[model samples]
Target chain A: MAQASGKSAGKSFFGKFGVHIAVLIFVVIWTIPTLGILVSSLRDKDQIIASGWWNSFSSSTQTEAGRLPGPEAQVEKDGRFVIEGNIFGDGPARTISAFGVRSATPTQFQAGQAADLGDGVTLQLNPDGTFVLSSPVAIEGRGQRVYYASSAPPRFTTENYETVLFSEGIGRSFINSLTVTVPATIIPIMIAAFAAYALAWMRFPGRALIIATIIGLLVVPLQMTLIPLLQLYNGVALFFGVPSKTYLGIWLAHTGFGLPFAIYLLRSYMAGLPKELMESARIDGASDFEIFLKIVLPLSFPVLASFAIFQFLWVWNDLLVAIVFLGSGSDQLVLTGKLNALLGSRGGDWEILTTSAFVTIIVPLIVFFSLQRYFVRGLLAGSVKGG
Target chain B: MADLTLRQIKKAYGAINILHGIDLDIQSGEFVVFVGPSGCGKSTLLRTIAGLEEITSGELKIAGELVNDVPPSKRGIAMVFQSYALYPHMTVYDNMAFGMKIARENKAEIDRRVKQAADILQLTKYLDRLPKAMSGGQRQRVAIGRAIVRNPRVFLFDEPLSNLDAALRVATRIEIAKLKESMPNTTMIYVTHDQVEAMTLADRIVVLKDGRVEQVGTPMELYHHPGNLFVAQFIGSPAMNIVPATVEKTGASTTISITGGRKAEVPVATPADAAGAAISFGVRPEDLRIATGDSVLFEGRIDYIEQLGEVQLVYLDIGRPDTPLVVKLPGNSELKRDQLLKVDADPATLHIFNAKGRSFARDHAPALAA
Candidate 1:
């Protein structure tokens, strides 16, 4: 009973309520904007601008101006001359809440209330976009213009995604992104794993210096090296008689920029592995390379996976590096670059922008969720002991 | 089967010396244990023999072949680490078969050896489980099984039983002892700080201090004929008690006076120049008893009593409050606090050491004297 009481005491107010509240706050902070983009992407083109994504599930109130049908279509309904027609003739129905004859007071009169036109003429606009304009004398050939506040029912469609993907070049850029990100992620991880194992386990000259150098490289801003590296690449390309901006160049560029942090992360984790495991393997007749491949690599899976996720996400969302290394051609443009081009060209098109934004983040979401198990385990691996 | 030899093996990490010129000869089929206090370089010595560590200066030979520069695997040695470093990601079967797999042995032969080792360790049921799934003793057996699968000529253990709880430690100790019995031709070198393990499992024990071996002998030899005060105090449980004394008579049999003016004759011989010199008198707790007649060595008051099931430990304050001499008596012995007690020990069991804490050479052989 004392043990139970102690356990309960450990799980007091802060442990139960405060922790969940903190997690809820973080969930709200991260997912709210992503959810907004997703909801906006699926909305109809006009409704996207008509209201916020939060109001997409309900009707939205918007002021619109419409003219009644001409006198030719109007019919006499009473002893006095009466012209009757729906303001929204053949369009979708909208509920008009208020109406006015002038643009300055667009909602001057409530729907179903009569408004005098100053010379014995009256106009009544109903909630269903229908209006009755009557006069003591015969009505004119042209119908009256009325402004009204109307609410349209919620609209949702997949046409925005269709248009953006088919015509906006996002699909091709997605494939280009895959080509860049997959190779960029794999190359750095492969090289870093080998370098990490060598630095962690193998005894050699200047190994500590190499480790310190890698840690130093981690702090060097990529902006400082991007130009110099590009120039170096161009020089090599010029000597080799090849195009300067190629997919291979971007892959190598990303690999070069990502290697320091990758090696740093992987080496620290690999070094934390039990030293006796390596010594035991050595005495078991396995060489350094064999031990690295069989023992170290298999045990380092958590770290490797986490690095892969990091590199994948960074490369996928990268615009500066992709723009600097790759060409602007349709076939070579990456997703982030293509998204930037779309922002400039279709600045007013909310549907296109939201759809593109959602598409760009979807792949990273899938990657993170798929590998997040290993990511969390990797973070906690150092504190836990194995048998 | 192989005989192992170490000659002046010295290990240093940039002047922080860990081992200082360790020289040992381990015969084939012999179980040798290295026991010492922490920081005595016992584990480092084992690693050096396993070739996991390189000696700064000296030679290591296995089966008459100098393997100083050879890789661990090429030296025909297998080591069981203290942590039982079984690959966490592999199953028990794979953990045992990893070495043979790396050596590119035939599939049939690898399967046969792995299965045989598994059966010997009674791990046939746990073959498919991961290391983390098994208990501590089970994991320890797997580690030993991994070493056995290699068919090594020289087997080394680096404090293998240190990680287990008390009950499991005893069980695994027996398992390791049985493993040695089954492989009688293989030369095994074990390292542990627990002298009980060294005393029970070792055919010969090497006691180390400050990176130097103090004495090498059988367990009983070290118990009865400790080469120095350190070896005497380190070997037995409850530790041998040592008190300051002055040598008043030096001859074939030396007579020393304790702090309370009580003089006792030790059968061991002292050097002729040791007269009027201070010395340390040592005796094991179990070797002492309540004196009945006039052969009493010292009289004191009972300070405390601990009643174990079979034996009780009686702490006697021999007028020295800081250093109470312990005596092991029967559990049913009638004893009380502050009771005047006269304790005595056999002359043969008494140990005499010089002022430098070195044991005096024994010229009075009990067997020849009889």
Candidate 2:
């Protein structure tokens, strides 16, 4: 028995370590992309182009070309003709590692060393980018081309955020996304809550048919309905003399798309509430409205919050719905649309793309973290009895 | 307070009928308990009166007005649920005050009534606590307190004590009895499957089976003079013992012959046509005693003895194979198994049920009229 128990203990220890390792792997997998975006968004624009985001915390080296003074500006020093200049003109100082006169081999010579030109002529470049060339013959042509490798220390800046928010128009799109998301999340919740409560607790003719239709709608793909719905909205807008592409239009479209799932989630929760509560409320001199407001709504809060988070995230990240319903005007384009536009225009600019992506994800991350407690509670509500 | 009257009330769902026509008149200030086995429609009947479930066909009146179509809030009734059904999010104060607040009562009146109820239920110190934080009995009291603050004409309880543990059930039952005494004008209807609660707490008991009323009387009246075999077995613990017999003579005092060639006389008035009819002899376990003289009614061998501390139950096999007659005797009685014994019961305490399962009227003082 002791041997068996000892073996079992060893098995449990391994089991626990295996679980922890699995969790660590998942955490790394989930966080790597987010960390990449955050690191890339904060780096200097020049440094962003120099290396990968993971190397942002270390120095980056690059080979760059520059020019020297011509023969007229050469001065005679110690019976030799000399030309002197800085490789990097009017820019932040960088450490020069090596220098070369040929493009084929930019770092052929190390800094602080003289290299012969095969006619008693030599060139020397210092670590701080100062270069001197001495020749027996007067230099007649334009200064010989010079190349050098310089290493810059790790750099960080907030300029990318400023440029994306102001010059790239992501700030305005952020407001537009909020406008579409808040009302779209709230409107469907209001309508679906009433529908769910009635379906779960109230008695009326055709109630079962209505519930079945809602469930059937859940399986129908939103892609199938998009065109018909757009056309319908356009017809309504024309008849009413209103603009077809408006925030209100997109809000309604999102509400329509989210209602089926919202009602499905909420009705099951409302139905699971003890039947005695409603009856007791009725006997306590409460009308149907009173019972809903006083009892049903409060008890349904967890499920409501869970659905709110879901709907908010979906509408916030939605590109297709916003693009189809709203105009692509600067004032109306949502963050997802703006990001798509940026991908087309600034396709090669890593700083612009990564910073914009990070900005787009911030709101959803905040919302998920804040309401995660309610989300867990709501999912567990109907599976257990009592509290 | 107002009296409630129901005339031929019935409820059906789709094609399945739950309640056959039930007619009952509950006087004002009466504490009536509806007791039965599960699925007996007692809870359904209570809900129908509360107007939570619509009655399919009936005439229901509160005081003098027919309220078939009236909403529940306007019916002047309140209910305490088996699960307490207190608003879980609300504090005890808010739970009891919910009804008054919905009625738009003034602040002072609501506060006054809420405090009065809290004082009555001994919940003054816990008014700010939520239902989840309280014990089950405390939650039940909060439910009753919620109903009390409504000050309705009638109060309904749907198995309020069934959810409590045994010790708490007894304590809360006594609390409810005192609550009824303090508010003598409000008529209350309680429903439960427990016979002890029915026997102790009810002014009158309504025994139901298969969605129909079998008998309705005061606790003692139903105990001593059950209208049929169903009530005879339902109202007592260890239930009443019944044995098959054949009627030999029918008169003011009818005589029946048992299966073992034993004859017993029961003091019940039966018609002359009942002679030679098949019948059942009924006696309670606690009513029989060991016979010491020659007037014994039954002779059997002891099959088994169950030794309870205060009393012992002796099972006897006279002739029936499926059921053995049990007699309750003093504890520590020196009676071994398989020993022959004779038992007898007073003729006045005996019961005779005709072939139709209906009990014949007794010749003693009329307990039914009382």
Candidate 3:
């Protein structure tokens, strides 16, 4: 009876407007700005400039202008080179607020009327694609291309994505990010898994102190050591006559920065493995290396894979460390650093920024999804008594 | 194939000693079990014998060769761990062949020995499967098979069946017994806390307590005559009921007055020194029966009744709440709780122990208390 009441109480509490209220609040918070960004990214740049992305759903009353016919079309109805055309064509026209021949004086003339040009010449362009020009002087070469005030329906373009990927060099940056990420993720996992097994299981002097000290190092942020580490690398490179700025420098830097946390996490998991399994291996005549390679490695695969995902995503999206430690030269720049550069140079081009950002995040998504299967809960097999 | 001996074996960690001055010997081809409670160092002793642990201050020998400084692999012993510790990455065939492969033995010899061990353990059909794919019993068999292929002189099993379910434990236990029987020339040391396993499988049971050897005897010998009170209570289920008694007479058979104003003649020879002294009389639950005579050892009301499938335990409370005497009856017997009853036992089935928890032998008794 108590359980039944408790369950009902729990049900009513969750159903008593709390869940719906929370979800309603969350939906209101998340959906609005995402919808705004989507609409803004999709809308025509001209429409975006004229109004806000919020006004995109309805047909927009925009002012647009086109050129009028040249002096050749101006037959001598009144003994002048007459040019005539309507600016708006084949549809219902919105209000033509003003028009001008020069861009600086775009509002020089009002719609549905002729403007005086001070030589007894007049030009008139209607909402439709027809115009009348009476010129005493012969209109040769290019006649004034009349700009008319007109409205344009709201529109969007996929050309932003195309320009960013093909022209902005984000596509190559995406390839470079994958190249940096995959190896960075894999190298640390292999090295740390071996270290974790030794630290967790292999008994030697100062094991506990070493583990405690490594855990202590976990809080020391990578930013604090970046310059000193890079200085050390450059000093070494000077001795070997190798270039200071290379992918080798960046890869090694990321690896060194990622190793402590990886080893710590993997060691905690490996230590939690049942002691009986290790003893069993010893009894089976397995040397310490065999036990580590055979039992500990297979059992610890999930933690290894989880740490790999963490390190991969971290290294893939890391721009600060990459910029500080590695060269910004075009050949050695990673995707994140390159994407940051693109953002500064092409800030006005939303297409270039969004595509570049998305390209940089794609590899992390793929890596996280593929290796996540290894992070299971009960890979221990319950081998111990009562476990 | 080998006689095992421990010469004053002791284990200590820093100032705290665990096993103190243990000495024992086993003839060739004896199946010895180290049985004790938790923290009794039975498993530790087994590990020391297997050379997985270093003996602190003793000479360990197999057929009179000292192995104190030898590594586990060089000790010529194979161990089956309680968790079976099968290599999860390898197939059963490869797992069994791993040791010889590590030694760089020829492929043909490795194959022949691994196949032979597989045939013995009935794992031939599943040789290609991994440890995770096999059941618990199959995994245990594979662990045993890995040990068998080593062809060592002594076999060590550290609670190898403790991980299995009841049915599988029984099945695998029978298989181990048969393995010991067929390989009669090999010395085997098994460790367990289960009394039935120790009783059924051990040629000799070495009972332990707090890192000290309590008693060592055959299962029936330990059953019939335990060396001390601890072994007496530890080796049986529904443990033997102990009642405080006073020695009233000294003769060929010791006569003691138990609680409820009745006397018992336990079949322990008395000396002139044991007249009018205090001792404890022990009776197994199954040995007690409803008495019709005046000298019933315990006369009381049944405080509780527990019914098994074939037997019933009648808990007789003579006001010793901590250690109440119980009498075992057949399952179909007419017995119930809250019934006033008289329980008695045969004189030979009784055990007499003095105040220090040491058993008094049937042939000899201690001198009188001053």
In TM-score terms, which candidate is top? 2
Worst 10 residues of 1 chain B by lDDT: B361-370
True contacts kept of 1: 0.95
Q: Write the per-residue lDDT of candidate 1 for residues B1-370, one digit (tens) a residue.
A: 9998889999998979999998999999999999999999999898888887888999999999999999898988888988999999999999999999988999999999999999999999999999999999899999999999999998899999989999999989998899899999999999999999999999999999999999999898898899999999998978998988999899999999987878999988887899989989999999998999988887888889888968999888887878899999888888899999998898889998887889999874666333
| Residue runs of model 3 more than 4 Å from their true location after superposition | A1-63, A73-183, A237-242, A373-387, B88-94, B105-119, B124-134, B249-252, B292-298, B317-322, B332-340, B363-370
**Sort by lDDT, best first: what order?**
2, 1, 3
RMSD values, in order shown: 3.8, 3.4, 6.2
TM-score of 1: 0.90
lDDT of 2 at B182: 92
Sort order, DockQ high to low: 1, 2, 3
Is candidate 2 or 3 superior in lDDT?
A: 2
lDDT of 3 by residue, A1-387 (tens): 999989989779668788889999999996676566656666666566677778877666654556655656666665666766555546555556677887777768876578887688787765544567778877777656666666666678766666656777766666666667777878888888888889988889999998998888889988789778878988988999998866667777778888898888888788878786776566556788888887888877777777877788799888887787667766567788887787788877664665566556557667766876753432222233222
Off by over 4 Å in 1: A1-19, A63-150, A376-387, B246-259, B269-277, B363-370
Q: Which candidate would rank higher by DockQ, 2 or 3? A: 2
